[model samples]
Target chain A: DARVTQTPRDKVTEMGQEVTMRCQPILGHNTVFWYRQTMKQGLELLAYFRNRAPLDDSGMPKDRFSAEMPDATLATLKIQPSEPRDSAVYFCASGLVSTGGSGELFFGEGSRLTVL
Target chain B: AQSVTQLDSHVSVSEGTPVLLRCNYSSSYSPSLFWYVQHPNKGLQLLLKYTSAATLVKGINGFEAEFKKSETSFHLTKPSAHMSDAAEYFCVVSADGGATNKLIFGTGTLLAVQP
Candidate 1:
C-alpha cells in the first residue's frame, strides 16, 4: 500500500525558531498539498504544488511561511521565526490528477508542531 | 467559491445506535462533496465522496452520504455506531470543481460513541 510519508512527527521549538517539515508523496502522485490544522481554525490549506510547480500559496503567511517542492518526491514547508500561534498539526496530502482520476487525496500521518 | 458548514460541533451516539452528521455546502458550480474522518493522533481519512453521478454514495466502514441539491446538503449517515467510530468528522467541498481538487474544509464535528 502506498502512502504519503512525513518527517518529524513531533516538533517542539521556542518562539522565533525556524521549523521545517518534510513530506514524501507516493511515488507516482504528481500533486501535493500542505494543510494546517488547529483547534480554532480546523483545517486550512496553506499551499499546493502540481508537477513540482506551485499552484497556490495564498493561505500561507508569505512573510514567515514557505512551501516548496524541490523535486517530485520531496515537498517541504518551512517557517522562519515561528510564532506561538504557529503551533498546529501540519498535514501533507498527495493525489493524482492527470489520469482523469477521482479527486481524492491520500494524507500522511502529519507533523505535530508546538511552538513555545 | 465553495464552502462547507458542519451544523453540529459535536455529536454523541450510543453503540449500535444510528449516526447522523449534518453538512451543508455552497458552491458556484456543481460541487464535489466529501466526508473525512480523523482519529486522535491520526491523519484525516476519506470516508466517502459525492460527485455528480450518484446522489447516494457509499464509503468504507459502513458509512454513506447523500447529496441533496435542493437543500444544498450532503449529510453523512450510518445505521449503527461503533465505539471505534468516535472521531472528528469534516465536511469538505472541492473549491475549484475539478481543476486542482483544492478543498475547503468545514470546522469539523466531533463524534463520540458510547458503549
Candidate 2:
C-alpha cells in the first residue's frame, strides 16, 4: 500500500544540537505537510509544499527551523541549535489536490525527537 | 483563522458500548472537518471527513461522524466499541485550498476501552 515513510523514528540530542527529520511522501500525492505534536500546543502545521514547492512555513520558527523538498519524493525539516522546547513528535502527511469534495491523506510513522 | 476544539480529554467505555467523541470548530468560510485517530507510538490515521457533500460521513473500521452546522458540531460515534478502538482522537478544520487547507488540529481526546 502507498504510505508516507519517515526516518529516524527516535532521536535524542543535547541542547544546542542540530536535528534533522526526513520524510518520503507517497508516490502520486501532490501535497506534503509537516506537523509537530507536543503536550503544550497539541498538533500544529509547521510547513507545507504543493507540487514540491513550499507554500507556507509561517508556523515554523524562522530563526532555527527550516523546511525544504529537494526532490518530489523527499522532504526535510531541519532545526539548528535545538532547544528543549523543540522536543516533540513530528509527523509527515501527503494528500492530493483538493479539487473535489473528498481529499484523504496518508501519514508517516513520525519522528520522535527529544532535546535534553 | 480556523480552529478546532475537542471537548473531552479522556473517555472510557466498555467493549460493546457505543462511543462518542465531541468536536467543534470555528471558521470564517465554509468549513471542512476531519477526524483522525492515533494509536500509541504510531502516526495519525484519517478516520473520516466532512467536506460539504454529506453530513453523515462514514470511515474505516466502522467509525462515523455527523456534521451539524447549526450546532457547529462534528461528533464521532460508533455503534459499538472494540478494544482496538482505544486511541487518541483529533479534530481538524480547514477553510480553502491555498493556505487555509493547512489544517488546524484540536487538542486530542484519549479513548480507553475496557473489557
Candidate 3:
C-alpha cells in the first residue's frame, strides 16, 4: 500500500522561528497539494503543484509562507518568521488526474506545528 | 465560486443506531463532491465521492451518500453506527473549470458515537 510520507510529525518552535515541513508524495502521483488545518478556520488550501510545477498558491501568505516542489518526489512548505497564529496541522496530499479530473487525494499524516 | 456546507457542527449517535451527516453545496456548474473523515491527530481520509456518474455513491466503512441535484445536497448516511465512526467529517466541492482541481472545503461536522 502506497502512502504519502511527511517529516517532523510534530514541531514546536518559538515565535519568529523558521519552520519547514517536508512531504514525500506517492511515487506516481502528479498533483500535490498543501493544506493547513486549524480549529477556527477548518482546512485551508495553501498551495498545490501539478507535474512538478507550481499551479495555485494564492491562499498562501507570500510574505512568510512558501511551497516548493524541487523534484517530483519531494514537496516542501516553509514558514519564515513563523507567528503564533501559524500553529496548525499542515497536510500534504497527492493524486492522479484521470479523464474525470483529479482523483481521490492521498494525504500524509501531517506535520503538527505549535508556535509559541 | 463553489462552496460546501455541512449542516451540523456535531452529531451524536448511539452504537447500532443510524447515522446521518448532512451536506449542502453551491456551484455554478456540475461539480464533484467528496466526503472526508479525520480522526484525532490524523490526516484526512476520503470516504466517498460523487462525480456526476451516479447519484447514490457507496463509500468505505459501510457509509454512503446520495447526491440530490434539486436539493443541492450530498448527505452521508449509514444504516448502523459503530463506536469507531466518531470523527470529524468534511464536505468538499471541487472548483469549476480548472485543470488544477482545487477544492473548497466545509466547516466540518464532528460525529460522536456513544456506546
Candidate 4:
C-alpha cells in the first residue's frame, strides 16, 4: 500500500527556533497539500502544490512560514523564529485529480510540533 | 466560498448502538463533500465522499453518509457502533467549478464509544 511519509513525527523546539517538517508524497501523485491542526482552529490549509509548483500559500504566515516542493518527491514546510502559537500537528496529503475533477486525499501520519 | 459545520462537538454512543454524526454545509454552487476520521496519534483518514453522483455514499469500516441537497446536509451514519469507532470526525467541503481541490473543513466532532 502506498502512503505519504512524513519526517520528524515529533518535534520540540524553544520559541524563536526554526523548525522544518518534511513530507514524501505517494509516488505518481501530483497534488500535495499542507495543513495545520490545532485544538482551537481545527485544521487549516497552509499551502498546496501541483506538479512541484506552489498553487497557494495564502493561509500561511508569509513572515515566518514557508512551504516548498524542492522536487516531486519532497515537500517541506519551514517556520523561522517559530512562536509558541505555532505548536500544532502539521499534515501532508497527496492526491491525483482525474478528468472527472474529483479524487480522494491520502494523508501522512503528521508531524507534531511543540514550541515552548 | 464554502464552509462546513459539524452539529455536535462530541457524541457518545454505546457499543452495538447506532451512530450518527450530523454535518451541514453552505456553498454558492454544487459542492463536493467528504467525511474524514482521525484517531488519536494518527493521520486523518477519508471515510467517504459525495461528488454529485449518488446521494448515498458508502465507505469503509461499515460507515456511510447521505447527501441531502435540499437540506444542505451530508450526515454520517452507521447501524452499529464499535469501540474502535471512537475518533475525531471532520466534515469538509470543496469549492465548486473544479478549479482546485482545496477544502474547507469543519471544527470536527469527537465520537466516544462506550463499552
Q: Which candidate wins on DockQ?
A: 1
Flag regions of model 2 displaced more than 4 Å.
Answer: A101-103, B97-100
- Cα error, residue A107 of model 1, in Å, equals 1.1
Of 1 and 3, the candidate ranking higher by lDDT: 1
For all candidates, what are the clash counts? 0, 0, 0, 0
After superposition, candidate 3 runs with Cα above 4 Å error: none
Writing each residue's lDDT as its tens digit, candidate 4 over B17-50 gives: 9999999999998888899999999999999998
Cα RMSDs of all predictions? 1.2, 1.8, 1.3, 1.2
Given candidate 4, what's the lDDT at residue B62? Answer: 100
lDDT (Cα atoms) of all candidates against the true structure: 0.92, 0.89, 0.92, 0.92
lDDT by residue (tens digit), candidate 1, B1-115 = 7889999999999999999999999999888788999999999899998879889999999999999999999999999999999999999988776568688889999999999
lDDT of 2 at B77: 97
- Model 4 ranges with Cα > 4 A deviation: none
Q: Per lDDT, what order, best first?
A: 1, 4, 3, 2
In candidate 4, which residue pairs clash?
none
DockQ values per model: 0.58, 0.47, 0.53, 0.56
- Model 3 chain B scores worst on lDDT over the 10 consecutive residues at B95-104
Lowest lDDT 10-residue stretch of candidate 4 chain A:
A96-105
